[model samples]
Target: MVNSDSPTTPLDSPLARKNPLTMENFHKFEKASNGTTDSMTAPSATISSTSFNSASLECASKETSTIQNETLKKRRNSAGHKKDYNQTLFENIDYLGCSKLNDPSNEPEMLDLMRVLDEQRMTSAVTVSLAVPHSARGFVVLRDTTGIELTSFPVQRIRFCVRGRLDSAQKHCFSISFTHHGINGEQTHQCHVFRSAQPEMAGRALYCFSQAFSNSGKENMSDNEKRIDYKFEAYLEIRENEGSQSSPHWVLCPQQNNTLKLRRDRQKRLIVQLKQVQLCKVFGPPLTVTKCFGMLLAAGRNLRHSDMQLLELESMGPGANPSVYVINAIWDPRIHVFDVLNTETPRDSRVFLTVAADVIIAEAGEPIRFRLEAKARVFHRDERFYKLPRVALREGYSLTLEV
Candidate 1:
């Protein structure tokens, strides 16, 4: 790198012609000058012929200093902008559901139905839940504030891009473009721009959506690693909705499959008795009983323990059996207990889960035991996973996501 603070030699000067202007030659010049310009001011009789033009040297020195000052100012501004960009991104971490399946943070992480600005058309405000089954794709269910299901669809494709400023009133912004496939085989294209009080939240959401496109089983797995299998037992209970004062809560049961069949209380909640969970290693998606049930179960458990707070699942399409609703969990809030948010990365490093399955009530009173297994390889929350995007030129300055 060039040091603009250093003086430059005149092109016609003998010193500039005799030696290359490398750091070593520059240091020699400094040493020969006795580390001071005092000699340049000495009487002409005392001045040596070996010295170059003193007037030219002084001009060059002034010019160098001015350049150095400008460079320093640019660097400072760039740093400030980068800091704001990162802050904007992390401020919305909870809304994006960026938690890894094995994360352990307990901070409430939920996607605020009101905060999402869908600009294509305005409809009555409704709450929505997102989920990811073993397929690793998005499954979204929209509901009213009262929790009545409105509509559900799968996100087929998504594109994330940065936009340029068009006028003095505009700034560089991030955008998310996605296509949602409805139950009737219809597709809807949606685009949302994030440049509000907290734009990083939109970026975080984009990162999570992109994870669905990554290789399902190969993205996290390294070659030569052996798959491990394990099992455990747990119980489930339905907390019936009573009244506004009675908040629903889960009831823990003891003993795995103790002849406790699945039953629904007055609120239409199904309580299951699951036990003897085991791990399974396979190549296909985890939507079936034999494939990725273990991974899906692990993800569900992780949601409770991780940093994410919102939960959603895929619902049956119109005219489908309302009696048996196939609920497939998608982008739920989860925290990676083993790691903290990679706020330093140029782009946020949120883990996307690849396993998904249906919450089906096959038999009212069947014994439930989950075999803990992952269809995809376990993802390591290490430094190598961090991502850094390239800087882009905007107006007069360059914008970068990293410092």
Candidate 2:
């Protein structure tokens, strides 16, 4: 009521008191201050965002550094484990100890010990005394455990000396027998006497001595001869065969004896001499023979030496090959007579005779005939006879007998 009665005061009125320009200035000032405050706060907010992004980057960098340190530590540990394995592998290898024992730097000491051992082991003493009027050659007697005895003929003059030891002391009581084969094929007489020990005892002693000799360098004669003046050895291999009723046999001096001595029951011995006997021969203009059924015969009617103008002879046993028979005879137009000479026979004379062809006869229509000229020569001719049978001659030919 007071405002309505008082004048229309502009300050009191709501519409009159508000100046448009002042209000507009106030609104503009308020907007400008608000804009300035917002600008200042926006910068602070951007600083906070930048600070948060920098903190995140620092955390990432710290994590990466820790991972790198762990990776580097792991790489260093793997290299140390491999070096310790190789040091323990090669510990025991000795090459120097083996070479020193094999060398013969002390051969004399070894020989002395061997001699002492040999004398102590002798079971008996054997002596042989022989008296000769002239210089005699040396001989060897081979004996074995089975009572096998072999006597070798006197060889050419050989320089040798006797060595013996008894009870650890060198003894000179042993003797050797001697014989001489005169140079002149004349009859020679000499009485050489030697004292011999008991047969069984001497055999045992000799066996022991032979063993010592074999052990002391005689095992390799070729190498031992260079250092020592004498080397003698003997070896006995006693093989028990199921079929043998007696003691083991001995094969002594294979080259010299070329025989096998088999012990049989009742002190009997079987001497199997490796003697070769001639088997056969074929001859015409040339000689040719077939080795069939351990027998010698012409291969065929047309397989004559005259047909091929060549001679071939073969062994009937294992590894049979054709061989040429050499003859000492002149070939004549009338008759090619071959003189069966000693030179024509093999030097060994051990071949078994199966067949022989002295001459070959051939006609156009008649069967060929091979004639025997001589008896087959063989080793131990006194023990065996190889006579050509009359039936062995061809149909029309006859054999000329030679006494």
Candidate 3:
């Protein structure tokens, strides 16, 4: 047991009086300077008091001043979080998304995509990681699962071929063929393919990338830079004869029979041409022609599936029937024909014609005119066209339009 009435140490003497480390006294310099005058305010325990060292008191005062300065700084910056200067550039921005293919049997690679809108251009960057083995001579293998060569560019001079299709193996995938220019003026082409689970998002991705690329060069240009402001409009009227009120008539031009010849050029490329028409309507045969409201054009390379070709064309609402229909042309693999089918059922009509032929569009007139042979076949959904009769024509064909 300890004695209750013993003399205290120097630490106990300081605790009996006011503590100098308290924030009230530490906040004011005058309280520490006038310590002798304020000593009377302290507890009257001088009978058993021990003196504190002058050097220790001075060191304590310096530490209190340093802590107070830090507290003042904290109060001044209470608005928001401070930016981290130690972080890298990529870490500073928000990461958008990435696309990768990791089949061990195939060429394994990953593509990290990043996008940002700057004052001048919309910038897109891709970081690629390849898992190819290096040879004894220190050359990395550059091959892909699809047997296409894979190459890359450091920063600039990258020309890309971006394609979005719903009928790909991954269903809604982007095939980006990147052409990288070498330092010696030689070009190397590499392809990176990625698929998105959200199929419609593939089109959105292409739109964003196109918008960014278009704005890259003309950031500083003004709207007033245009040299001309041109505008014009026109109308047309098709007149009918007095005796032809009971039956429907072919608008603008009459129906006539024509032939399509499919042949190959010297390079073995497909060349599809149509035979000329007489441009007259005859009344004897009572030829059945349904007024088709719209036409869709599509193209495909794979012939395994019948509906795969339709995936190439984005849906266009029913068009005005027999009006001159125009379709955009595709550059790759080249398209030769456009098929016009009667999607309507017999509950709607009977013996409707399905035409497959090449059309020459005349855009110079008031209303457009699609010039082609009027000959077409009566299509049946249940009936297979494994063979064509002497008078019957082939059915079901379309082509994809170019961007």
RMSD (Å) of each candidate, 1 decimal: 32.0, 51.7, 30.5
Residue runs of model 3 more than 4 Å from their true location after superposition: 1-156, 217-403
Q: Which run of 10 residues does model 2 get worst, by summed lDDT?
A: 55-64
Residue lDDT tens for model 2, 33-73: 22111110000001112211111000000011111111212
Ranking by TM-score: 1, 3, 2
Per-model TM-score on C-alpha atoms = 0.21, 0.13, 0.18
In candidate 2, how many clashes are counted? 26
Candidate 3 local Cα displacement, residue 299, angstroms: 73
* lDDT (tens digit, per residue) of candidate 1 on 1-403: 1112223212223453565433234234423423121101110011111121110000000111111111222423443212111111122111110111110111111011112222211331122332321222333333334554333323222322222122312122233333323334343322323332333333333344334334233222322233322232322332223333367443221112121111122121222222223244422112222211211333222344233332333232212422212222322112342222111222222222222232332221232323221111122222121232211111111111110
Among all windows of ten consecutive residues in candidate 1, which has the lowest summed lDDT? 55-64
The lDDT values for all models are 0.25, 0.21, 0.23
TM-score of 3: 0.18
Task: Indicate the residue-level lDDT of 205 in model 3.
Answer: 37
Whole-model lDDT, model 2: 0.21
